[model samples]
Target: MTLKSFALAAAMGLLASTAWAETKIGMITTLSGGGAGLGIDVRDGFMLAIAQSGRDDIEVVIEDDQRKPDIAVQLTDKMIQSEKVDILTGIIWSNLAMAVVPAATAQGKFYLSPNAGPSALAGRGCHENYFNVAWQNDNLHEAAGAYANTVGHANSFILAPNYPAGKDALTGYKRFYEGELAGELYTELGQTDYAAEIAQIRASGADSVFFFLPGGMGISFLKQYADSGVDLPVIGPAFSFDQGILQAVGPAALGVVNTSQWNKDLDNPTNAAFVESFAAEYGRLPSLYASQGFDTANLLLSALEVADVSDADAFRDALRAANFDSTRGDFEFGPNHHPVQDIYAREVVQEGDVFTNRLIGVALTDRADAYAADCKM
Candidate 1:
């Protein structure tokens, strides 16, 4: 054989040997304590997709950050340094997302965000290594703010936790609702009791109240809001009153209005199949959180099907180009590394045997986020 043929044969042998090797996916999420609802949903969704795709080339290493940013950094460091994972995925909070994504990207590993899109990463700080399968931090809230304006909800009260996501949510709400301001309250992060705030809310005399709180926070707030004897209409983003909260808040979430990019009620074949299969696998209705997680995994699989994930440049180019069809009806990358999609106004309603928030109105069909123009990336 020629010398060139011998070299080619040796390279092909190495590729064949590593073809069945485990592809480690380091998933850092809030798996313990109060934040487990969303994390569990995301985990189930990812596993469901993996099983359906029938690709055994991946092994997922799931860890719970427990909603602590410090623990997230530590666990992610271990995953990157010790396990030598091929990719990193799943984060439930913005702070944790910000803390871990940079490390993953700096090492030239792909970081897929199933949830949590911090505001800073959407602008000039946007990195090519990071890809969000969820909407931007403010994207859903911005849609809620627009709906507030459309419904003539002027002089509204706003409440959010005193943290990065809380600040971003309120900022997003005010971006489009150009009406008279009533009052804004920033509470401590993870505070369970909303009685004090409920009292304050009663006295604020605002026409409507808008809030952004996820997981346990939403559960507590929705229950308290219903019991507080406040008659005003309550509005929030989907994350604040999602399936996770519905299980906790029970009937308290009824009649609440919120906005989201995807809901199970969407009339599309992709979503229908996903919801049915997810329910059969997990024995529960899938939330948008789960849908996004599944979509993130599917998105990676799509790019991998076309190009080698080990080729950093090729994978990044394909993801940045948004060349895959998302289960959310459409897919397009905005300038800020976020997605431009439809935003639906959903209301908490009981559909058949399950209690859920279904889309009642189309808030913004094919909407672009407010910060896209400001983003220079």
Candidate 2:
């Protein structure tokens, strides 16, 4: 063989050498503790997609981060060194992502985010190996702000947790609301009791309320708010109204408006198949996180079909091409490798015995993250 041909053969051999070209993925996500529902949904959705694709060449090692940053950091180390995973994904919290993503990518592992798009990573901290299948941290809240104005909320009181995602949540809402601020508050992460906050909301003289609590925090706050006699309309991002926690919140979430990139009722073939397949496999209705997880898996699978992960540049290009159909419809990655898609308003409603969200209308069309401009890559 010629020298050039020999070089090409060696490169191909290296690419094909990964356990006979079987892709290994490491998923570190919160599977236990307070906000476990979100991570469980993400994991189930991703695994369901992989099963449906029938790709035995793809192997996954899943671990529970337990919603702890220190433990997440340790898992990242283990996944990269011990498991020898080619890719890492399934982080749900911005805090956990922040602790894990930078180090993981720096160590040469491609990281796909099914949830948690911290603004820091979207902008200055952005890496070519990092991709977010879910909306940016602020996309839904920015949509919520616009929707709040459309529905004639003039003076709004907003609240979120005191974490990175929480900080992004309130900022996103204020960006487009074009309304007077009646009050703004930040609560503790994983806080279950909101009696103090609800009392403040009642006395804030606000015409409307917006809160960004997710998982159990949302369940506790909504039920408490319902009994507090604070009759103002409540609006939030999909995290607060997702199917995983809505039933737990009971009737407190009904008629509440939330913003999201995907809903089950969205009209499209990709979404239809995903919704149906997810229900059949999981025996439960999927949440927005589930759709994001499914999309993340399909994105990786699409890249795997076109370019081997051993060729990082080629694989990154394939991922950027975003050839897969998303449940969100018309989805694409912005310059920062984050989703650029339509954001819709959804209203919490009851379908038979199950409580869920129904699509109301599009709040933002073809929206990208606010920090995309700051992404130098």
Candidate 3:
């Protein structure tokens, strides 16, 4: 062959290789509203992992959903149709996840959930292209229920927002609680005032309270509940009391028991490095949400090393293998594409003015999602 022909052929091959090497990712998370703290942590943790990976081949497009389902749907459409993202991740709220995931997966794009594992996506609606790196919505609450049972809390007041995830949270608590409800209540989404709820809790004579409010709602409730002077013990999912908002919740959150899949003090090399590096980078401790984001990014990077995103089957299998070292140890995906890992009871404690959770004990071991059986996929 002529030298010019050889050079042209080589250039064409290089162009194809470069195109194949690039993996475009889109991140839609709540970054400007009530739940912004959770989304910020997830985005930061995810970016931290991507930076650590030092892979120039991955390009990311990030958008703020504003905690609105309509905005999330719009962003998903733009990302898939215009941005041409190979993967989508970093949604904080279940409502937003529900709006965006099915559509994204239906269009043959991968959706890796760093947070928000609504039971709907875990059960009969499960999609082959959807992977939840976080626990199912019910996992932590179920653990909370188990903890309540262990602590002999026979009659508990339970409350969450009137939403799909909120209902799932209360239902999960009842599944393993083996107790009578003092009162079951649902608050408006993003409701800050808890005066009426506090009054009811005080009047109900309940020995304990289980709440599933996240982000700003949790902070408000904790502060109000403390000021109300109700001596009832509080139990909730770690989302309410995670490191991101613990300082905001202040000492009011102290001694509260919560359930989580990952804690900063999990005693693993990956977790140690993640907690230290995350604190150094962000000037605060990492939350369970942050840990999930970090893990999700690493999971994608791991899959990228072995499989090209263009091959959906290969990429899905690579993700299911879960090759990365998780901050939450013993992490693996269940048949329903949700995590099967241990959930622990965590008690909020103040360590030099910063509130954080200490691992108290394991609430559930090697636990898989309850909806896995319902997942036909």
Candidate 4:
């Protein structure tokens, strides 16, 4: 072949390779240990979103931090430096989110939070570079708190682990609950036994109980709560009674009320499609964790369409605009860098072969977060 022809052919090959290359999105989560179920859901949901969008050029590099803060930070740093990832996402725990988000943002990569909205990040710690597709730590609990007031549950008991996220959950509930608090209990983080706490709750004789315990802790509480035979109604945030825990708790969790931003039975066109596709792909119903993950992918894709997102500042600005079709219907970022969305009160129901949650009512919709005023971002 002629030298000019050879050069032209080589250029064509390079162009084809570049065109076929995918946009790499670094996803770090607690893939193993206790939080594995939630991580699996997030991964599956992100993939489902990508499939539905029909965007072949996007890719996700998933890493499991095992719910460890140090591992999370290391994985995030590697993703930013070695992988040269275009975007960063995942993280299930508030501590992990706190550990990694700053580094990811300081490096000027867009950090999309699929879960974990710590109060610190919701207030003055908010950064333009960080965007949370999930509600703030308090939003869901606040909805429950409002529901408590509406239901005439004048006296209530609150329980949570002694952590920043746990504290935020209770504070969120208090934002809307004007009634008298029967009792408040804060246990050590990751404590399994709730026998002593259950005794206290029974003694308190509150009309309703609120709690925040995700993963194994949630399972332990649900099983114990059922065994305790507490006559009063049970209410709390959704994470503790999530799909992951439902399998463990069995029918013990039935009739439980929880507040959340998303449920498997939303019945919206977008959510229905997402749920159907996710269940088919993962062989299980999608939880709120998965819903947030799907929304995060959608959010990133929307920003990518608006602008190239080749640089950090441009991507951050685009994300701040919150231009995406969130599964929750109304998708917008509040000043606190958390989602301004509806919170639903849902009941755990046994749906045919699987246990899933159905919405009881919309407790709050398009509500501004309590801490939004404190967030200058």
Candidate 5:
């Protein structure tokens, strides 16, 4: 070939490489320890959405936080300084979120929360570039409290772990429940044995019980509570009653009503497709965490379509628009960049030895976070 032709081909190749640089997304999630299931679902769902979008101009970097706050902090720094990721997402626990989110967003990088929506980030600590695709920490707990009232739970006993989300849970339950509190307890985080807690509940003289334990904590609590023969009707947020947790809890989770923003049985074209596709791809039903991850990816994809990430103002405004069709049906961002969406009451039922949740009813309609009013943004 002539020298001129070869030079032209080389010039074209360099131009192609220089243009359309793939957008980098860093995901710091719990993938190899307690609560790994939650983070795994989030990662799979996010990847599923990205795959279906068929977009070649995006790249994702994933790291396991190992359910440690320090690990999450380190991952955040590595993502920002070394990986040069433009966006960050996929954190499961509130304490880890607290350790990672503030510093990441403060650096002018966008952080989209697929889970772990702490109250501080929703209210006085709100940021322009931070978006919570999942419900606020209080959203489902508040719905559980509201549903508890309608079901004639005039006096209730509530408990949660001693973390940020746990504190948010009890506070949210009290905010909406008109009932007198029979008792309230905060267990140590990741406490496996709930014997003492159950003993207290058994003696508390409560008509009903509500808890906000997630991951293995919930499985242990439910099994022990069932064995203790506390026949009082129990209610909780969907964290404890997720598909994987329910299976581990076995019959202990049956008939327990939990509140959530999405369920496999929600009636909508979008949700129907998600459920069908997720089951086909993963060979299992999608849980609340999975749905949130799918939505988070789609939300980011939509914003990327309309505005470049380098233009922070335009991208932030696009995210505030919340242009994705969520599995929960309608979804939009409130002033605080948290979701303003409906919460549903779901009941656990067994189908051929497999445990899953079905939508019983809408617990709260168009529920906005209690902290939204406090957010100046």
Candidate 6:
């Protein structure tokens, strides 16, 4: 062959190899057991983004964590060491995120969290390779606390599962809530019974009750609370009143106020499209978890389009730029890699047969996380 032809052939071979290179993502989320609904929505929302991207060069590996920290750790090891994924995302629980994110980021794999931002990761332990697309664990509850103060609630009863996220939720609430606590209770993780807690609240003389019980626990508590006929105002973070479980909670959740960063009715083009598309595809309303998952996937996809995941610095920069339109109208990252955005108070209301949240008012505006100063990176 001529010298020119030989040179041309080599160049074409390199181009072909680059075109076929893959960006593998490992998604470990709770897909079964108690928090299955939240995980399923996240997985589905993430997969929808991948499908919409229509890029054959990107590959995704999904696994069910079953809300177990040990199982999530095992999955992280297998994904990073064996499957050789370039990016890791999708963990629903704070404990699971804690188990997997630090270890994965320490090993040089990029982790983009769709849900579960623990305070430990946000503050002193922040890693350069870790980014949380969702708000820091305290953001919503803090907004709820602020709202409680606005509405003249003097004494509030509070309860949460005894875990890292649960503790963070209460701390977040109390950070802004200047009122005295009527009672503070910690329930067991995945506890199905709230009868005892309800009795305590009934005797505590609290003007309002605030609780952070996600997944099935929320459903159980709300149902039992309604049945007990304790007529105090109820408030919580959006986790308990998410669209995935609102229907299950039914009338029990009606008129309960909660704080969240995203709602289906958010009047932004990106959010409107997301809500419509999610409902059409999944046959249900999208929850805050689903919004976080969608945003996380889009953020990754935006970075992927501009920089290859192998180029760590460029990829991280692109992810941090947050170029894509967010379902939450205005979204930016704090120095700690958690979201800085508005948190709104929403009231659970029934629209036809489906239960959902409606925006009442903004609780916090342009809020940065409490841990940004601690993160040097």
lDDT by residue (159-231, candidate 3, tens digit) is 9998888999999999999988999999998899999999999999899999999878899999999999899
Which RMSD values do the candidates have, in order?
4.2, 4.8, 3.0, 3.2, 3.0, 3.7
lDDT-better candidate, 1 vs 2: 2
Over the stretch 1-377, how does candidate 5's per-residue lDDT look in tens digits? 99999999999998667544778899999899767999999998999899989998898999999999999999999999988899999999888998999999999999999999999999999988889999899999999999998899988999999977899999999899999989999999889999999999899899999999988899999999999988999999999999767888999889999998999888989889988998999998888899989999999999999998988999988999988888888999888999989999999999998999888998899999999888886
As for model 2, its CA RMSD to the true structure in angstroms is: 4.8
lDDT string, candidate 1, 23-109, tens digits? 778899888887788888888888888788898887789999998999999998899888778889989888888888888888888
Model 6 Cα displacement at 66 (Å)? 1.7
lDDT assessment of candidate 4: 0.85
Query: How close is every model to the real structure, measured as TM-score?
Result: 0.92, 0.94, 0.94, 0.92, 0.94, 0.94
lDDT measured at residue 316 in model 3 versus the true structure, 0 to 100: 91
lDDT of 2: 0.93
lDDT of 6 by residue, 1-377 (tens): 99999999999999767645988899999888867888899988888777777887888999999989999999999999888889999998888888898899999999999988898899999998999998899999999999999999999999999988899999999999999999999999889999999999999999999999987899999999999989999999998899888989999999999999999889999999888888899888888888899999999999988998878999999988988889999888888888899999999999999899999999999988888888887
TM-score of 3: 0.94
lDDT of 4 by residue, 88-171 (tens): 888888899999887787777778888888888878788777888887888888999999988899999998999888888889
Clashes of 5: 0
lDDT of candidates 1 onward, in order: 0.84, 0.93, 0.92, 0.85, 0.92, 0.91
What lDDT does model 5 reach?
0.92
For model 3, name the residue pairs that clash. none
**Candidate 5: stretches off by over 4 Å:** 1-20
